[model samples]
Target: MEKEKAHESQNSKLTHENRFGLGSSEHVSIEHDPDDLWGDSRVIVNIGPTHPAMHGALRMVAKLNGETIESSYCQFGYTHRAKEKLGENRTYHQFVVYTDRLNYCSSLLNNVVYAMAVERLMGIEVPPRCTWIRMICCELARVIDHLICIGINAVDLGAFSYFLYGFHQREEAYTLIEKLCGARLTTSYTRIGGLMYDAPDGWEKEVKDWVVRTRKVIDEMDRLLTTNKIWCDRTQGVAIFTKEDCLSYSYSGPNARAAGIDIDLRRDQPCLFYRDVEFDVPIAKEGDVYARYRVRLEEIRQSLNIVAQCADKVKKGPIWSEDKRVKIPDKTLVHNTMEGMIHHFKFFMTGFDVPEGEAYTTFEAANGELGFYIVSKGAPRAHRMRIRGPSVYHYQGLDLMVRGEKIADLVAALGSINIIAGELDR
Candidate 1:
């Protein structure tokens, strides 16, 4: 009884201290909404953790009046795995694996961002071929992710055939990814200075074949949904947000593109091999769900174009640099030479040291600006690492979109936002 009381007292004291901390109490109170105690509202609808259209374990308490939403509140943390806390305990390389969990639809991009940020902090220079390969693979991932988003949105809007067709193409893309990397969904293929391994022999031909097949699939998807009267009626002019509004909310990628903001990190920031490549950024004037859908579909074409360019420009060269500090020495050399063996052992065990600096690297992810902010205290492991996820921003804009719109449109709006809960909760 005494121990229980002491425990409670300790918790209370901690809570009191936390409440008084700088900006902590203010943020907590806003998130918790203590005034929601009465549960009194007109036509309250709870769409939730178990709902088919909810995507992941997310709940939205919406108040409506005859097909018009008055106000809405989102509930998260159901799928939270304490990713930030988990990063603190793991080594730099081990943390790369955890990044696969965030925005699992485009896990490769997440891993790339994490690795790139670390590389920046470490001042490690990757090979040109590796950078180009990362760009190509991440662009492919963007297309795959958009297919899921647009197709799923169509499904929610009662177009089942489109979903099947899109997913079919996505599966083909997945197979290609699986062939390139050992794993499809969770591809930790990227290392500090280069890939885990070079693209397999004849991988270029495989990429070409997939591009041809995907172009056909894209044509079929367009015919099935893009020009269909039902699809147009359901999506056009629904859940609109302007360019200014999106910018104010820190929106990025397709969401921003849909609002006529022509900002693609690949073009504007020019990271990796993006500067050498040529591709168009598709933009739509209308910020409706349909506009977002159209932007994504057009983006698939751009990605295919980039893949073709990469295939043509790609040369037979070393994928990894000759930096012993960043990359392990060749196995043949390690076995035959003492110096090579020593270099390999040192890299694997101690890892390389990073410069004492911070860098913020942003990439054009499937959803939006997937950013990684890393602060290195001159250690192999980062002093601090933060992920800037699009889903969180998308979730923040949900109330604005859903309110005053039909309950049925909720699913369409949510799908268009492409709020993968993994990214949101993380």
Candidate 2:
């Protein structure tokens, strides 16, 4: 009780730096009770700044009445790195690495989205081959991201088998990523107007094999946990948010779909070759932990289907556009030809300038709608920049959804949303 009062006293001073949202996305000041005038049964607990249930780098300050939560406030500055400011300071090409940190589970998606924004700003359309590759990368990363979210959520609830099966398949996907980017986790594998390179020889065959193997693992997970009474009990009706609440809180991606709100950018606002592919946007009305799990599980299957289609249709073609502005010259040409040497030097020394304009590009990232809003005055770096990461809104909904829910349900809800602190704080 004393702890709760002390913390409330501290919060009373810092309310401006940390504001709490209502049940909706709109912010409203919450009264802090520095005195335990309510009751002595209530316990104040700090969930995490470094707890496993936090999925690393998230902290929540919650006031609990017995095991049920009363009020909750989440803090996210622990992993804050001034990423949006970095976008403004660094050249467009240099900012891609920073995006990798935003949602580390699907760095490839970040790379592609930021690339799309830069390409849009410069008025360059990537080749058919490049767009296809980007789509494949996005889906592959989706598979990996969804795998982590579902597997970890189950693991948090004491189901280890799913985590093992899902992680093994995730590693297989990483092998394909490594083959393409020469790195696994933080893959800076995109160029502004194209990819770092064309798919390595026979890479499509490797991805097809991985997808086949991953499907078996997904099926095994469904059999192992989907009907398990323990999982169902823990997740079925817990941490529910109604469709209206989902909209009010600006929920997107799987979180929104889990609440029976169908708004996938890939279908409604198609970009790249997303419209060319056919896949279902899985949704559920339960808006509970189980629904989020099911939505992600089904989405993984759809992503696998997309990956298969991309692999089959990935015909050989030019990977980079003819736009020399963003293209790094071929090394052989750089060493031998004066023209190539000059172009290479100019490209790196004076990075391609953008026209004096601004544009906002949105990509259906694994988490949700990832939008990059950029303003440029024809400089290599952006004059102003902003990132609309879905996690921020998702985190806002946390306190409302977890109200009166058990402490254990809190863990499940956090994992279900898959909040990446880097994205949340930025």
Candidate 3:
């Protein structure tokens, strides 16, 4: 009778725990030998604050049952440097330099967006030539950024040769950018009203040469991976998001276009020199990792076309606008005239006044839409500045892609998202 009572009591306790999800089979183990009750049932794995596949300092705590992932949660901020707080404290010009640290792959895009936002608040109009030049440089940045995304993704999928080829082409693009602006990675080349300096003499010829070489490299990359059976097997049907799902999440760029949504800020809501240029936005229907890869590859071709046209139309004129409020007088002029000297000193020290208002501007960055929201209180320092980085949006959508996917597919999904932790955490 006592044994029966004890058995009922233990069964009631088990039932009570299971009903509340506190002692389900996943969390509990029954042992014939009571001494063995302390053995581990749950498998805990740390996927990396330093893992090779993690891309950056992103970590994932994954719970596994044998080889299958039961649940996973991501951790970030290992690379955080409090960029927003720094922006709040710095002057507008100083903040432009910090923008480069957001997404190092496409730093120029960030610079352009931030500068444009401030310029809009100040009602500063950039010259037509300067606008075109900004477009050209940002497009070049798009190509460089996409090359890294596609190549690194391919590497994650075991296509090492494609990564090498992509990197080689990207190096050529970077060389052109460096030659034009004298900076490589973090190009703080775009100024508030225009570019930091004029494109070097013979820049058109260098850009033309790069355009031709890049086209050949794009063809080579296509030949290497586009129809390869192994490449398709690895990425073709992996990590798909429907168009509706993409829109619901506010996805943009190749990520949205991969799901068959036709929305390119360059074409739809034209800004800078995009309104004057003619180019097609490549899109794919599958929304898979392979589809995103294909879309970005085609975009490289379109970017080259834009660069070729810009090279032909690029005028030899002042890189900065004529507005005295925004542009400091040329150093040579400052030496020649008292008015130029005083204007130069005042512009450098006091800066220009921006009316109290807010503006949001977005550009077609390599990964997606890169936007800046700025608030001005008629001061040299912005009252508030916010960045709507594409990587942040992509990071938020990751769990949707990862859940119900195989453990290996998580790597593919991460690559498809193409998130830069610096942008995400910032």
The models' CA-based lDDT, in order, is 0.83, 0.88, 0.83
Q: lDDT tens digits, residues 146-215, model 3?
A: 8999999988889999899888978887887788678899889888888888888898889888889889
- The TM-score, computed over Cα atoms with residue i paired to residue i, of candidate 3 is 0.87
Per-residue C-alpha lDDT of model 1 across residues 334-387, encoded as one tens digit per residue: 999998888877776766677788888888888988888877777766677788
**Number of the predicted model whose lDDT against the real structure is largest:** 2
In model 1, the runs with Cα more than 4 Å from the true position are 1-41, 332-350
Show where candidate 2 strays beyond 4 Å.
1-39
What does each candidate score in C-alpha RMSD? 12.9, 9.2, 7.3
- lDDT, candidate 1, residue 139? 75
Tell me how many clashing residue pairs each candidate has.
0, 0, 0
1 or 3, which is superior by TM-score?
A: 3
207-249: candidate 2 lDDT, tens digit per residue = 8988898898899899999999999999999999989999999
Return whichever of 1 and 2 wins on TM-score. Answer: 2
Alpha-carbon lDDT of model 1: 0.83
Worst 10 residues of 2 by lDDT: 19-28
Top candidate by TM-score: 2
250 in model 2: Cα distance from truth in Å? 0.6
